[model samples]
Target: MTISQLIRPAHSFRLTPVVKVASFHIGRASAFRATKTIENGAVNEAVVLPPKDKVAGSYHWDFERLLSLSLIPLTIASVVNGAHPITDLFLGVILPFHCHLGFDAMITDYYPSRRSPVLNK
Candidate 1:
């Protein structure tokens, strides 16, 4: 028997994917509300947007910039100094923290806790 014939038996069982990507075009935003209503006059809890701290927001941006800028000098110093203990220690802490801030920003912008809480971890 041919490979195709062997793969497809006399009795063929069709299967479909759980999620199909029919098109690359982006779809309009659609809300999926629950069809069922409250049984005994109960109400859905209000989901307020987390409070924003204006002062802290500015400070946060400033810190992000500071951390990133601080890396430049440390990076140059490390290359010039050639494997010094002090430079290694500084890079060890600052580099990870810098990366962490970038990741945190990405997470906050994309999978916000208010929306995709499950993806936070």
Candidate 2:
């Protein structure tokens, strides 16, 4: 048998009708509301725009990962009393940064000031 016949069994596949794309697009100033049906049976929905600053632009994943990974080596050095001064220095610097990022993530997830309009500002 040929490779094409072996792979497909030839006439099994058929194409379906493609739906037309929506003419309207969501913009920055869009206000969200309940979906409403028009006389022609087309559905419409409102879009809500959130405050710009609610999404932070500056998120430092690299620095946060560095601080997290540093803890492992620093803890090991402290336990073994290896390279006392350098490890102490790194531990002092990294510990606070690690705590700050951890708490910041907790606050971002649980507290979520952005969801509350009054507190978000």
Candidate 3:
């Protein structure tokens, strides 16, 4: 790797899979969404698990531990203080984000590339 590449901050690997899994949630909600037909007469939805991210595996455990552990202090502060603005705000946001990461991991595991790549994407 070049100096510039090495020095640059690592791109976000965590949020990517979450985004891929979350893409289906974007746009308006519809009970029966129409599929697009391609030249070969096949659906061309582009969403898929962008090949495996090797970088993410290196720090996956660390990230999950940090996020979950962080909630301890925030939760304690919020409970002890009872409705303090900063604590309440962080707890509100971080809690949901933590939950999203967990569910994303679950989706990624159960829904492999060989199966429904759409949802696992």
Candidate 4:
């Protein structure tokens, strides 16, 4: 065996089937929205999921816009209150969650875990 192959940990055998199962679930979820063709060779409109950016008047970009708009007020209130009990309580709950969402989105865009076929050692 090559030195590189010897050093690399074996890839998890479960990954391929897990991914296939997840794909099946997604297909099932969207099945109701599947398009249908009429006998006359015309296609009928199908139900579809809405884009996240409902606020921006753009039919796309929902998740980013939600985090941006929501965090602004939360940050302002937290700063103005300066750790007051009520603000502290609300901020404690929301700040970490918002930060998590933003970081998760960034990481997904930059280095998608799903895009890689093999897990890192």
Best candidate (score: lDDT): 1
lDDT of 3 by residue, 1-121 (tens): 8897667565633544543555355555674677653234337765566788878686976788888999999988888888898998888888998999899999988877556767877
What C-alpha lDDT values do all the predictions have? 0.82, 0.71, 0.77, 0.63
lDDT of 1 by residue, 87-110 (tens): 999999999999999999999888
Kindly report which residue stretches of model 4 are placed more than 4 angstroms away from their true locations once superposed: 1-64, 113-121
Highest TM-score: which candidate?
1
**Model 2 over residues 1-121: C-alpha lDDT tens digits?**
8887678754575564476666886665545665553234325755556778733644576677877887997898899986688888888888987997898776666765635434423
Worst 10 residues of 3 by lDDT: 12-21
Q: Give the TM-scores of the predictions, in the order they appear.
A: 0.54, 0.45, 0.51, 0.38
The clash numbers for all candidates, in the given order, read 0, 2, 0, 3
Candidate 2 backbone clash number = 2
When 1 and 2 are scored with lDDT, the better candidate is 1
Global local distance difference test of model 2? 0.71
TM value for model 1: 0.54
Clashes of 4: 3
Q: Candidate 1 at residue 66, lDDT?
A: 99
In angstroms, the error of model 3 at 84 is 0.5
The TM-score between candidate 4 and the true structure equals: 0.38
